[model samples]
Target: MFDRATTFGEALEDPAARSILERYMPGIAASPMATQFRGGRLGQLVALVPALEDLAERERFFAALAEVGDGAPRPPYDPAIAPDPAYEPDDVARGSAPATLPGPTPLWEPLELRFAGPSHGNPFVDVELEAVFTRDSGQVRVGGFYDGDGVYVVRALADTEGPWSFQTRSTARSLDGITGTVEVVAARDGAHGPVQVDGFHFRHADGTRHRPLGTTAYAWTHQPEALQQQTLATLADAPFAKLRMCVFPKSYLYNADEPDDFPFVGSLAEGFDLTRFDPAHFRRLEQRVAELGALGIEADIILFHAYDRWGFADLGPAVDERYLRHVVRRLAGFANVWWSMANEYDLLWSKDIDDWERLAAVVGEEDPFGHLNSIHNCRPVYDYAKPWITHVSIQRVDVYRTAENTDQWREQWGKPVVIDECAYEGDIDQGWGNITGEEMVRRFWEGAVRGGYVGHGETYYPPALGLEGEVLWWSKGGVLHGTSPDRIRFLEQLQSEAPEGVWDPLPSDWDMPWGGAEGQVKVGYFGFNRPRFRNLILDDGGWRIEVIDTWGMTVETLPGVQRGQVRVELPGRQFMALRLTRLED
Candidate 1:
């Protein structure tokens, strides 16, 4: 609508509306008209008029434009068409008739976007749109032709809701080539402001989902009481079937010989007495185990990284094996306990493995407790002692940095794998590197439950209670100790309610969208651990079957199976599921 300047121009027979326009737009009144309008924060602006209008009115406004600055870059203005007066939602549904409207046809121009701010995380870009109009309706949409990445967020604002739709057109080329379209409906309200919307979606070049392995670590050493309390709270709220507790030998902590320079000491071991085996230590551990049991939590204790100063040298023939026997005998009585032979014996000297094997054999002989036994490998050394070990606890290290290598370890082990310790050095100083709080949660859930590996949760360096310097290793005065209680809750919620049959593989690799084509292979698996379901069923094509044993070994396979695919299904969430195929197959 023209301002009061239109009437004034007509009354005075002034060829232009410059006199009235000058008051509102100051710099444009100059003789040469040096003022210019830019398509900056204010998106492309346009003026519209009914076609039936007289040229006298148009000439007045257009001639007034002559008073504006010359040689200045002025944004191109496109007029928009008015909505069809007869168009109605009900009429369209009935297929009765087509609606018509007045005014010139609307024109759309390519939107130019600029980086307005830094990205929030990896591969996320933030942009700002210029040339926005305050009164007219405008919209913008984005998409990629290739499928590597897609929109992650979108937002819009308006005085009132308006009709609009976003379109994402896919292409076979790189993700960068994708294009987006935004179609805005014609509508207007004098008082209402322009509309804006923001949102995002995930897409892959080949239309396949990018599912990465995730894992977590449970390093609760500094505040035993607080850890136990918080863990109990987490278990009560969410379901966590397995938990790991690191048990350092005496040499690793409270070393009077090197009190000032102990490698990883965090605090003095609570109730640790090297002179004699104390009943209280075991009792405290038992109490903790009982608490875990009350909330359906199971404990996996580390027996390798000794807190004792004697270290591996004391494990030779000179030290009677009876001493080791007594240690396991006293601790094996707990119901919720699983034995982890060593922390990272692969990293330790080969002599450490000898001592571990001897100790493991003795513990197996003496305790005779039907509990499960496994060893946490420092790297991927599951093949070294497979015959003696029940299952291999592969420490899937720094998954954020070395995610690509995970599949290699899983393939070689060919056994049920538990990511015993998964974490990054939080002290690296790059604001937690590429991993984020949300990604951390996703990694653990995807790696263990989705990827079919027994996943453990871990946080970096635990805080030091009063036990600083003498008992614990890697303690930082309570700054980094204890479990992220909220994270546990989130994990439990996600795992406890995962889809049924999620642990089983698809009917066949052929069932996948891109099964055999190059760069088209898709691999995924699902499994869980819970009291409700305990058995694992592995499918060997055409009705063939095999059962996974308690030790996680595929004991037997039906002969003469023709199916190339294997499907494993368990009854409940406590089981792990894995599905793997070549990415480019």
Candidate 2:
């Protein structure tokens, strides 16, 4: 908006443009990005909106730019106006609603309203349906999804206790102008609805703490029946509260095989009908997800991924909407679902930032339960501060300092940080899949004590797990060979004992010293450092210190230390940590 230059050349050279670029992207704005704009493809500009420090100022800058012209952003949905139910559709049917949802729906559980719609000329693309559910709290406009067989469904979440009313609007006469009412009851114990971001921490809808000790098993569902069973069984006792898996099969470095089944009905060739979904594949996935929920694991369902031999990653916007809508209908109903937009969104070379946003809108429009949403990264982290993103799902770009930057990321994003993919633990060929188990455990402790959720993965050498030489754990998810899982489980136990289970990053003096709160508890992790003894100056006395051999899996409490100027001893080895807690009495 600052001095609109008639030509791209003038705009790139303008001092005003330079200032604007420095404020957002900086450094690159005047150089490569400016050159990129000069060459064309200006819509890539909206990706810079996340870099702005002020949330309100981004709107001011966008107000003047042309629609996708010179990189102007396509605005994300305003949570307020986007949910309003005032918009009317073409026809309103004044017919009897076919025996609504049986009885009272549980609070936070999805109350699905089904309708019969026209099956003419590709129902997935032609038909459009929406609903508005109103309670004393407010009204939310939810979009309807087609379930393959001329059936349209709308799922809505009840936030409060008591009766909630709703009205349906549709483009076709089959499912419009109908209204219904249902009672909302309390949520089942331990079923805390969906997970939400609560000020740098993740919590359940019922306000219960969710100390996320997560792990990744990418193509677990694509494995054999016996292997899949083994993975689920492993998860039952594994120290993971959250699991990251893909909706689509992964085809990458180690994994070269096709999945057991694809989500779509047709082949992976171009021009295939994405509108028609494979119900069998979805049914199988739903079973697995339900199993995960029963085992108390939050399912971080990755919708789109780039590593592919199939054409699933290259669908257009219209078909993408259909795919996402069905996904919301089928998966979002689960209380343990968290939507990861893509595994590495940037790698989807066909998709721009705007395309990803449109898909995010479909999630917001269809998922009434408001599940936690985030997009993971490969190189540069997707601007995690975006409005649509609920938390930071980070795949560490830096090999050595990924988990170490947990505090920095938490401070920057002001959201719960999940280091979703920091390298894996194994003796495999790939650099990413060959870190020692000790380093993996050390990474978890580093992120754990720094108030970030670190994710784990295993990729041991093949034939080592009593299986074929090619199907590795990182890709196949059969069994665990590394020792990091047990160590990570121990970290979870330590976090559970604290009332303030969610940790916050504090200023570090030693090898990254972190505190639970206002000096109630403190942890100092000497990652690769090995100091025998150190002197601590305490302002207040009653603090107890324990020597923690993180990899050795031992906790030894050191006694006979006085109030001020206490002496603390350590193992003087790698992956050693010290836990200091102030005694109540």
Best by lDDT: 2
Candidate 1 positional error at 2, Å: 96
Off by over 4 Å in 1: 1-239, 249-275, 306-320, 397-411, 424-434, 445-451, 454-502, 505-585
What tens digits encode model 1's per-residue C-alpha lDDT throughout 1-585?
222112222312342444544543334334252323321111001111232123354346544544543334433322322223222223232212121111221121112111112122222112111112122344333221100122222222221233333332211111112233233333232111110111011111223221112222223432345544654564455434556664442343222432221112132443222222333444455566557555445566766552343343223332324334434544454444567776655433323345566767776765433345777654435353355565556655554533223334545654344555554323223332223334444345444332333343332422324433332222211232333334534434333332321121123322111111122112222322333322233333233333322123222433444245544444343323222222211
Question: How accurate locally is residue 503 in candidate 1, as Cα lDDT from 0 to 100?
Answer: 29
Q: After superposition, how far is residue 88 of candidate 2 from its true place, in Å?
A: 18
- Give lDDT for model 1: 0.35
lDDT of all the models against the reference? 0.35, 0.73
Runs in model 2 lying further than 4 Å from the true structure: 1-100, 116-120, 269-271
Task: For candidate 1, report its TM-score.
Answer: 0.40
**C-alpha lDDT of candidate 2 relative to the true structure:** 0.73
